[model samples]
Target: MSDLLRLLPWSGPDGRRCYVSADSGGGPVSRLADRLEELQLDTGAELLDHVEELLRAHRVSGDELRFCVHRLAEALRDALRVAESRGRRIPVPEDEMEDEMEGHPEPPGLC
Candidate 1:
Protein backbone atom coordinates (compact mmCIF):
# COMPACT_ATOMS: atom_id res chain seq x y z
CA MET A 1 0.00 0.00 0.00
CA SER A 2 1.34 3.37 -0.92
CA ASP A 3 0.19 6.67 0.54
CA LEU A 4 1.76 8.90 -2.05
CA LEU A 5 -0.24 11.94 -3.04
CA ARG A 6 -0.08 14.21 -6.10
CA LEU A 7 -0.74 17.90 -5.86
CA LEU A 8 -3.55 19.05 -8.14
CA PRO A 9 -3.01 22.16 -10.23
CA TRP A 10 -5.68 24.31 -8.65
CA SER A 11 -6.03 25.25 -5.03
CA GLY A 12 -9.14 25.43 -2.91
CA PRO A 13 -11.15 28.60 -2.50
CA ASP A 14 -9.67 28.82 0.99
CA GLY A 15 -6.17 29.03 -0.51
CA ARG A 16 -5.11 25.51 0.51
CA ARG A 17 -3.35 23.23 -1.93
CA CYS A 18 -5.38 20.18 -2.97
CA TYR A 19 -3.91 16.73 -3.34
CA VAL A 20 -5.07 13.36 -4.61
CA SER A 21 -3.74 10.07 -3.35
CA ALA A 22 -2.52 7.67 -6.00
CA ASP A 23 -0.51 4.49 -5.78
CA SER A 24 1.41 5.78 -8.75
CA GLY A 25 1.07 9.00 -10.72
CA GLY A 26 -0.66 7.28 -13.66
CA GLY A 27 -4.13 6.84 -12.28
CA PRO A 28 -7.26 8.27 -13.95
CA VAL A 29 -7.29 11.48 -11.96
CA SER A 30 -3.57 11.91 -12.54
CA ARG A 31 -4.15 11.53 -16.25
CA LEU A 32 -6.85 14.16 -16.10
CA ALA A 33 -4.48 16.50 -14.32
CA ASP A 34 -1.85 15.90 -16.97
CA ARG A 35 -4.31 16.75 -19.74
CA LEU A 36 -5.40 19.88 -17.94
CA GLU A 37 -1.79 20.92 -17.55
CA GLU A 38 -1.15 20.51 -21.25
CA LEU A 39 -4.21 22.55 -22.06
CA GLN A 40 -3.08 25.28 -19.69
CA LEU A 41 0.35 25.40 -21.29
CA ASP A 42 -1.18 25.67 -24.76
CA THR A 43 -3.49 28.41 -23.60
CA GLY A 44 -0.59 30.26 -22.06
CA ALA A 45 1.36 30.11 -25.30
CA GLU A 46 -1.61 31.50 -27.23
CA LEU A 47 -1.98 34.27 -24.68
CA LEU A 48 1.70 35.14 -25.03
CA ASP A 49 1.30 35.39 -28.78
CA HIS A 50 -1.61 37.72 -28.28
CA VAL A 51 0.46 39.81 -25.90
CA GLU A 52 3.23 40.08 -28.43
CA GLU A 53 0.83 41.22 -31.14
CA LEU A 54 -0.78 43.68 -28.78
CA LEU A 55 2.58 45.12 -27.87
CA ARG A 56 3.40 45.59 -31.53
CA ALA A 57 0.19 47.51 -32.13
CA HIS A 58 0.23 51.27 -32.03
CA ARG A 59 -1.92 51.40 -28.89
CA VAL A 60 -3.04 48.77 -26.39
CA SER A 61 -5.30 49.65 -23.49
CA GLY A 62 -4.05 49.12 -19.95
CA ASP A 63 -7.04 46.92 -19.08
CA GLU A 64 -6.40 44.62 -22.04
CA LEU A 65 -2.76 44.20 -21.21
CA ARG A 66 -3.50 43.57 -17.54
CA PHE A 67 -6.09 40.91 -18.36
CA CYS A 68 -3.75 39.14 -20.74
CA VAL A 69 -0.93 39.15 -18.18
CA HIS A 70 -3.18 37.79 -15.42
CA ARG A 71 -4.43 34.93 -17.56
CA LEU A 72 -0.94 34.08 -18.72
CA ALA A 73 0.30 33.96 -15.13
CA GLU A 74 -2.54 31.65 -14.11
CA ALA A 75 -1.76 29.28 -16.98
CA LEU A 76 1.93 29.29 -16.09
CA ARG A 77 1.13 28.40 -12.48
CA ASP A 78 -0.99 25.45 -13.61
CA ALA A 79 1.71 24.12 -15.90
CA LEU A 80 4.33 24.43 -13.17
CA ARG A 81 2.19 22.54 -10.66
CA VAL A 82 1.63 19.75 -13.17
CA ALA A 83 5.37 19.40 -13.69
CA GLU A 84 5.94 19.35 -9.94
CA SER A 85 3.34 16.62 -9.42
CA ARG A 86 5.19 14.48 -11.94
CA GLY A 87 8.49 14.90 -10.07
CA ARG A 88 9.94 16.81 -13.01
CA ARG A 89 11.52 20.21 -13.45
CA ILE A 90 10.56 22.39 -16.40
CA PRO A 91 13.46 22.47 -18.84
CA VAL A 92 15.51 25.64 -18.70
CA PRO A 93 17.76 27.04 -21.38
CA GLU A 94 21.36 25.90 -21.02
CA ASP A 95 22.64 29.45 -20.68
CA GLU A 96 20.11 30.16 -17.94
CA MET A 97 21.11 26.98 -16.14
CA GLU A 98 24.75 27.96 -16.25
CA ASP A 99 23.93 31.37 -14.84
CA GLU A 100 21.99 29.77 -12.00
CA MET A 101 24.80 27.31 -11.25
CA GLU A 102 27.43 30.01 -11.06
CA GLY A 103 28.60 30.29 -7.44
CA HIS A 104 26.19 27.47 -6.57
CA PRO A 105 28.17 24.44 -7.56
CA GLU A 106 26.81 21.06 -6.52
CA PRO A 107 28.63 19.49 -3.59
CA PRO A 108 31.43 17.12 -4.62
CA GLY A 109 30.21 13.59 -5.50
CA LEU A 110 26.61 14.83 -5.47
CA CYS A 111 26.24 15.81 -9.14
Candidate 2:
Protein backbone atom coordinates (compact mmCIF):
# COMPACT_ATOMS: atom_id res chain seq x y z
CA MET A 1 0.00 0.00 0.00
CA SER A 2 1.07 3.58 -0.51
CA ASP A 3 2.14 5.74 2.44
CA LEU A 4 -1.19 7.55 2.48
CA LEU A 5 -3.15 4.32 2.66
CA ARG A 6 -0.92 3.22 5.47
CA LEU A 7 -2.00 6.27 7.43
CA LEU A 8 -5.73 5.41 7.22
CA PRO A 9 -7.66 3.36 9.73
CA TRP A 10 -7.96 0.03 7.97
CA SER A 11 -9.86 -2.54 10.01
CA GLY A 12 -12.84 -4.78 9.44
CA PRO A 13 -14.02 -8.36 9.87
CA ASP A 14 -11.67 -11.36 9.75
CA GLY A 15 -8.61 -9.15 9.76
CA ARG A 16 -9.67 -7.59 6.51
CA ARG A 17 -8.79 -3.95 6.03
CA CYS A 18 -11.02 -1.10 4.93
CA TYR A 19 -9.30 2.09 3.91
CA VAL A 20 -11.19 5.38 4.16
CA SER A 21 -9.83 8.09 1.93
CA ALA A 22 -8.51 11.27 3.55
CA ASP A 23 -11.40 13.16 2.06
CA SER A 24 -13.93 10.67 3.38
CA GLY A 25 -12.79 11.24 6.95
CA GLY A 26 -14.06 14.77 6.77
CA GLY A 27 -17.78 13.78 6.83
CA PRO A 28 -20.41 14.54 4.17
CA VAL A 29 -21.62 18.02 5.06
CA SER A 30 -18.18 19.53 5.29
CA ARG A 31 -17.25 17.72 2.15
CA LEU A 32 -20.24 19.21 0.34
CA ALA A 33 -19.29 22.67 1.55
CA ASP A 34 -15.75 22.26 0.31
CA ARG A 35 -16.92 21.05 -3.09
CA LEU A 36 -19.38 23.92 -3.42
CA GLU A 37 -16.63 26.36 -2.57
CA GLU A 38 -14.37 24.78 -5.17
CA LEU A 39 -17.03 24.93 -7.87
CA GLN A 40 -18.25 28.35 -6.79
CA LEU A 41 -21.78 27.02 -6.53
CA ASP A 42 -24.54 29.43 -5.57
CA THR A 43 -26.83 27.11 -3.61
CA GLY A 44 -24.77 26.72 -0.49
CA ALA A 45 -27.69 27.23 1.88
CA GLU A 46 -29.86 24.66 0.14
CA LEU A 47 -27.08 22.08 0.06
CA LEU A 48 -26.32 22.69 3.70
CA ASP A 49 -29.97 22.24 4.60
CA HIS A 50 -30.06 18.95 2.78
CA VAL A 51 -26.96 17.78 4.57
CA GLU A 52 -28.39 18.80 7.91
CA GLU A 53 -31.49 16.78 7.17
CA LEU A 54 -29.45 13.73 6.32
CA LEU A 55 -27.39 14.11 9.48
CA ARG A 56 -30.47 14.38 11.57
CA ALA A 57 -32.05 11.35 9.97
CA HIS A 58 -28.95 9.25 10.47
CA ARG A 59 -28.22 10.50 13.98
CA VAL A 60 -24.69 9.40 13.29
CA SER A 61 -21.76 9.72 15.60
CA GLY A 62 -19.26 12.45 14.87
CA ASP A 63 -16.70 10.12 13.33
CA GLU A 64 -19.24 8.19 11.26
CA LEU A 65 -20.95 11.39 10.19
CA ARG A 66 -17.65 12.73 9.00
CA PHE A 67 -17.14 9.62 6.92
CA CYS A 68 -20.57 9.95 5.35
CA VAL A 69 -19.92 13.62 4.66
CA HIS A 70 -16.68 12.75 2.96
CA ARG A 71 -18.43 10.20 0.79
CA LEU A 72 -21.08 12.73 -0.18
CA ALA A 73 -18.40 15.27 -1.01
CA GLU A 74 -16.55 12.77 -3.14
CA ALA A 75 -19.78 11.88 -4.87
CA LEU A 76 -20.42 15.55 -5.63
CA ARG A 77 -16.92 15.91 -7.00
CA ASP A 78 -17.43 12.91 -9.23
CA ALA A 79 -20.73 14.30 -10.45
CA LEU A 80 -19.14 17.66 -11.24
CA ARG A 81 -16.38 15.97 -13.19
CA VAL A 82 -18.92 14.04 -15.20
CA ALA A 83 -20.83 17.19 -15.96
CA GLU A 84 -17.71 19.10 -16.98
CA SER A 85 -16.53 16.31 -19.26
CA ARG A 86 -19.89 16.46 -20.99
CA GLY A 87 -19.53 20.24 -21.40
CA ARG A 88 -22.40 20.89 -19.04
CA ARG A 89 -22.50 23.58 -16.41
CA ILE A 90 -21.58 22.44 -12.91
CA PRO A 91 -22.90 23.43 -9.47
CA VAL A 92 -25.93 21.38 -10.31
CA PRO A 93 -27.76 20.39 -7.17
CA GLU A 94 -27.15 16.93 -5.74
CA ASP A 95 -30.89 16.20 -5.79
CA GLU A 96 -30.87 16.54 -9.53
CA MET A 97 -28.30 13.76 -10.00
CA GLU A 98 -28.48 11.73 -6.83
CA ASP A 99 -31.19 9.47 -8.14
CA GLU A 100 -29.35 8.85 -11.36
CA MET A 101 -26.07 7.95 -9.69
CA GLU A 102 -27.85 5.69 -7.24
CA GLY A 103 -29.76 3.91 -9.97
CA HIS A 104 -27.02 3.76 -12.59
CA PRO A 105 -23.65 2.80 -11.28
CA GLU A 106 -20.70 4.13 -13.23
CA PRO A 107 -18.70 1.69 -15.30
CA PRO A 108 -15.29 0.75 -13.96
CA GLY A 109 -13.75 2.96 -16.59
CA LEU A 110 -11.10 5.56 -16.12
CA CYS A 111 -12.10 9.15 -15.42
Best by lDDT: 1
Residue 22 C-alpha lDDT in model 2:
34
Tens-digit lDDT track for model 1 on 23-83? Answer: 5567887788778777877888888888899999959899998888788788778777777
User: Which lDDT tens digits does candidate 2 get at residues 6-75?
Assistant: 1212124654533333334366643553454445343434566667887778766798678667766865
Q: Give the lDDT of residue 78 in candidate 1.
A: 75
TM per candidate: 0.65, 0.30
Name model 2 segments beyond 4 Å from true: 1-54, 88-111
C-alpha local distance difference test of each model:
0.71, 0.47
Q: List the lowest-lDDT window of 10 residues for candidate 1.
A: 102-111
lDDT of 2: 0.47
Scanning candidate 2 in windows of ten residues, the lowest lDDT window is 1-10
